[model samples]
Target chain A: MNFPPPITRLIQHFRGLPGVGPRTATRFVFALLNKSEDELRAFGHTLVDFKHSIRTCKECFNISLQDPCEICSNQKRERTLLCIVARPQDIQAIEETREYNGLYHVLGGVLNPIDGVTPEQLRIKELLTRLEGEQKFQEIILALNLDIEGEATALYLAKLLKSRVPKVTRLARGLPQGADLEYADEVTLINALKGRRDI
Target chain B: MNFPPPITRLIQHFRGLPGVGPRTATRFVFALLNKSEDELRAFGHTLVDFKHSIRTCKECFNISLQDPCEICSNQKRERTLLCIVARPQDIQAIEETREYNGLYHVLGGVLNPIDGVTPEQLRIKELLTRLEGEQKFQEIILALNLDIEGEATALYLAKLLKSRVPKVTRLARGLPQGADLEYADEVTLINALKGRRDI
Candidate 1:
């Protein structure tokens, strides 16, 4: 059965979202139908105003309401230590730990050759320019994921920045908190043993 | 970290959806951030226009662009055979089967006292009124789910409708088309055996 044009259009928009299929999209449309008119209008206004209200931070390339973003503009953060990440959401994840007090640079994505993501597509040039500018960062931390693409990107950046910067480092890989040794993968076990510290 | 007001509001809207949590809602908001301005505006317009474009069918209580709905207005459908379902989506499901060419009556929901879903909340009155009207239905099929609420609803309706309608029936209870005898539950196996046909 053919849904109404408005419902079909909304379903199509929802279907464009990540991991959402036709059935889920249809369910979303029906759920929306149950909402009050004012709620629907508010949701619509939010979508329309989303892009206008948010802008890419010029200093760090993180999406924010301000040009420099909260972290970049803040005065108390450790300016000499820069943490490089693949996405803005990663910054939030790190912030939740309350361990890192450094600034952040969002690279947008990793070096994914299969999907055609390269150095030119990333903010590598911008990062180099930032490093070369007046700000003298003591260390550059490649806080990327442990996946293949993240590893390749970290390696490429570390090689390019080794001579330019005082120090370049990647996040330590080890068995995660509460992980069982029996179920721990070989690579993680090896990394955990290699990086083990005396208690 | 606190997101921008617009981003947070949009995330809240996505969080209101069924089965979506804070993380998924945040993911949805970020995904929408990547969409083009024009696409975002189109989606916004669709949401705003959703309620205005759709109306509940007065005759069958189905949500549609038309008041009577396409099914109620269609002349080719079998008017004398009516199928009663709990929701409008069930109508679409039955239509996809291509087996039932009869008219439909959407009950809005079944009788669930725990959730405060009483007979007054459902379209039971509307159904009775329609049955008492000039339309002489040969049979009224209670096509509800086999769950507790559905069973209670069907039993209640059967008792109420047995004297009102010429004939009242229900969908056959048996093993599904691809169901295995070994894996089938005891209740389903008993029903399948009891309802066995000559074939």
Candidate 2:
């Protein structure tokens, strides 16, 4: 009766999301209230579409509208070279660079025991399958975050891939430690890509 | 090809929102990617329902699913006292106090000419109408923000209401300047309500 009850429930749902506290959640709910019915419906549809219309690329575990994804289907990209990233957004960051024309492998997560995320829990098995298959990758570039988890994941991947692949590299350390690939400036990404060294 | 071109559009849309920048937007998009198809659809449906189900109260301009709103319809509420707020969320803050059982008036927005919002743009006319009928308000509390704009709006309303209503009181100013009522802690709000003095 006070807030129509449903609005309160919606605010609570918003507050459940990461980084959204009670105040921010309340603001967001009211902001939605300010929107016209059409706009609100559109927002809801977008959220639904984003969830339903999008799928993970079966090949790279990257987000897409299809199974294999456009990148996986494209013949122009170098299948011999694969870039390893922690999340789908990291792949987007690298794609924006327009430097690498290679394929990608999304790990889905980093190796963090504290969070109970292990390499086995990630898409590492898929990467291994791709590497050991008839289509062999000549190089694997680790483009994960520069944080502790990223470093640990990269190191674990490097150790795993070094014995299998011809070459294994990580994004250069010129990138500030603890920086996310998604947040790194294009210039920094380009620099890191160009200056990448053997890891 | 990498992340589905439409994903970029969604991320850009999120970044355009207030307080959401590129990095946070990417985080949100990736979090979306982690959700299952059903969850995504539910999120979308919630958004759409949020838009479709909610309506502004006709009399007080408060966000609700009803016309007069539950608060306005409640028989137990004090009809002689009206609490004026800048937005719908402000009403929530006042309700949490349990001290006030009066009906509410949502101004919709403060007077900000720079953004091209005039007195006519808000619910001022409806407020005046509410006070004009045989059901008159004994005290009209201006519980708006304490910022320059809020102060300006309150002053404008006080002057206008003085000739119409018997009493036009404002929420006390011990509340930190520029602080939003929605963000103020319960103790501060309660104290402000307790220490309220006549303007």
What DockQ does each prediction reach against the true complex?
A: 0.76, 0.41
User: For residues A59-164, what per-residue lDDT tens digits would candidate 1 score against the true structure?
Assistant: 9998889998988999999999999999988998899989999999999999998999989999999999999999999999999999999999999999999998
Clashing pairs in model 2, backbone N/Cα/C closer than 3 A: A44-B48, A48-B44
Q: How well does each candidate superpose onto the true structure, as a TM-score?
A: 0.93, 0.81
TM-score for chain B of each model, two decimals: 0.94, 0.85
Off by over 4 Å in 2: A51-55, A175-199, B5-17, B51-55, B175-199
Per-residue lDDT tens digits for candidate 2, residues B81-187, read 99999888888888987999999999889999999999999998988888888888899999988778998999999999998888989876558779899999987
Off by over 4 Å in 1: A180-186, B174-190
TM-score for predicted model 2 compared with the true structure: 0.81
lDDT of 2 at B163: 88
Per-residue lDDT value at A69 in model 2: 82
The candidate scoring highest on TM-score is 1
